[model samples]
Target chain A: MEQALYQAAILTFEELGFIFPIERPSDDECENEESTRVSVKFNGSVSGEIVLQVENTILPTIASNMLGTEEPLEDEEILQDVLGELANVICGNTLPSIAGKNEVFRLEPPRKINKLEAGEKPAAIAHLDVEESRADVLLYLN
Target chain B: MKISSRSDDILITYALGSCLGITIFDPIAKVGGLLHVMLPASIVNPAKAANNPYMFVDTGVPELFKACYKAGAKKERLVLKVAGGASLQNNEDSDQFQIGKRNFLMLRKLLWKNNVLIKAHDVGENFSRTMLLEMSTGNVILKINNETTIL
Candidate 1:
């Protein structure tokens, strides 16, 4: 399940967000620990949440790439919306792989959130390096 | 879950859509704690709950209170504030999995059972929220749509 989720995230980033991710085993290989997070809750065939946390500095690049614009995006709102949309896309793609092709799933809108709290362990957490920025995806299945 | 005692520390919790963020602060003790709960019940996944109480409302709420007490925050002197419990926008047909509504109700139930009353709260909406607790003054700020509001 974790591997499936990681692949789905990579596909979404490359195809939809125009970003590429490289797997990193440790934070020492990345720049800093600071990140921006978003989560989308899903129901139907299965229930759980998909959370994506990305390094803050790379948000502008993500937003610009997703929008296909070269101009620098100075707006925080656009960047957050892009992050939420990316989480939504990742959840939509990952669910079918986990729940099977015959199952149907309904997803909640993605929202910007704080870091994952202690004790709420993710079923699968993947760390990806995106152009020197660190991005993590956590899957919590119920 | 996080706890703070220094006046300079600011506690914050984000992305409370369908989840709940709770804070308890005691001005006298100069202590504060923040908890972010993801689900309404631990019974669905008892194994996970056993190790991580903060994942469920029923189990997490109590543990949060206990932690505050341990940090020198008196129950009576504690000011409780809550935020989050938002559903997805344009998602009205699926009432069977209204996790946000359920999460909030469970929180209220547990708090009431403990004879604890919420001083302020923001719940049930289609918007995401980020909450902050300033330990210096016990003031809680809710951030939504890039605007901050006192709660």
Candidate 2:
């Protein structure tokens, strides 16, 4: 089941115009079950976080992509939209695989979070980071 | 002249690929309106006119204008700004999802008929965007990820 989830992340990236690799979260970031965090690192400073929950994943990729520019990035609003879309796309791709076909899942529009508060309880959290030259995708299932 | 208000402000959100968000503000009347329209025109989904009025340009634009007018806005004083209509993932695998380009074209036609002009806009890209229009001051904010820009 975990491998399937990882494969889905990779497939989503390929479908979403990002190039990267997948890996496990470091020991320091491990948490309880029902929460997952996936991290993927890509070239050009394009890194993103995917926080999974029963309702939705706080996909922070849209913000990352906007900020992941070769030029010095300085916009906050665009960053938020980018992260929201990233989370939306990652969650949209992963939800169907976890839940069976019959299960109906509706994703709310992605919202921006200034910080990932400590000790915040979520069903799952996933973090993904994609780079231009290489990419890293990490899933931290709670 | 039409102006629309949603409680304290009007919240219009657009999603999916290659779709745009158009917001009109009439400062004189202190009225603001937003539309999270998907396609450029009704041709994309002519059959679902009554169901998803907000999803098409033809019906949605008129409705948005009417809503504004009802709230006490005039056509001459309206200010317009647009966002969205992005294509972060360009895939030719299907034609059903070419909503971004069609949406832009439809908006152009509708505005032309009404003699409405767009002042500022952010459109066409592979990235998705979410926009907010504040009615109090007619402030338009665009969000992408960690960055926020007032346009």
Candidate 3:
């Protein structure tokens, strides 16, 4: 499950956002950076959610790159929207690798989470670093 | 937040933004409580939370349940409902202060840790809300804009 999340994040970020995620990233790399969290819920053969937490520092680059713009976007919502789409795509890719392509699933629109308190354990987690920023993909199964 | 044993008492909370409005009711006891919490954790400012526990989710939730228990509400029979976590992200000057989302997350984390499940919720959006609880029937009501409905 962690591998699936990592793979999805790698593919989505590289292809769509033009950023490469570092494997086996240093845990302390992003300790002091702000993080933006987004998640997409899916229901069908299984019900659960996939979460993406990215360092806020690299969001502008990711958003602008995904939109084919060289300059950073002027709107914050656009960056949030891109993160939402990133979660959606990563979720779309993740379910298939785990559940097989035969299974059908319905995914809800992505939503941003403001803050996450102490640990609420997930089924699996993939932690990576990108552009000196950190990205974590958490999978929750219900 | 208020707890009522009176059959005709109405507990209502208004203009809930990123703040969380939690309602707990016990049908058998005819007791109900409404809680409105502004911040996620009391640790942000211990002085404020110590003075008014209702200002934060961590402190307010425990207080809400304790009060309900004192008012004769059994934890096992309590029906919990939540509302109000908004972003205010509409139009040009959108405000992305995600206090509402933070409050909702903190509430969920706290509830999950205590083995509590929310029966219903009308949460997360770009609009403000007003929540009401009827002590008579334990019906939770949500009023947004000109609309009113059961939550």
- Best candidate according to DockQ: 3
Instruction: Give per-residue CA lDDT, model 2, range A43-124, as digits (tens).
Output: 1111223443211122234233233332323354554444445446665555555555555554556553333446644334
iRMSD value for model 3: 16.8
Where does candidate 1 stray beyond 4 Å?
A1-142
What's the interface RMS deviation of candidate 2? 14.7
Clashing pairs in 1: A113-B15, A114-B14
lDDT of 3 at A102: 94
Against the true two-chain complex, what DockQ does each candidate achieve?
Answer: 0.01, 0.01, 0.04
Q: Per-prediction fnat values?
A: 0.00, 0.00, 0.00
TM-scores for chain A, candidates in order?
Answer: 0.91, 0.51, 0.90
Model 2: TM-score, first chain: 0.51
Better of 2 and 3 by lDDT: 3
Kindly list the interface RMSD, in angstroms, of each predicted candidate in the order they appear: 20.4, 14.7, 16.8
Q: List model 3 lDDT by residue over B1-151, tens digit each.
A: 7889999889999998878899999999988899999988788899999999999999999999999999889999999999998877773236544567668766865676576889999888778999999988999999999799999
Q: Kindly list the per-residue Cα lDDT of model 2 for residues B8-36, writing each as its tens digit.
A: 85464745357678788888887787777
DockQ for candidate 3, please give it.
0.04
Residue by residue across A32-115, what tens digits does model 1's lDDT show? 357788889999977999998888878777787667565646597887888899899889889888899889888998978866
| Candidate 1 lDDT, B31-117, residue by residue in tens | 999999999889999999999999999899888888988888899999999999888767644544767777876676566546778
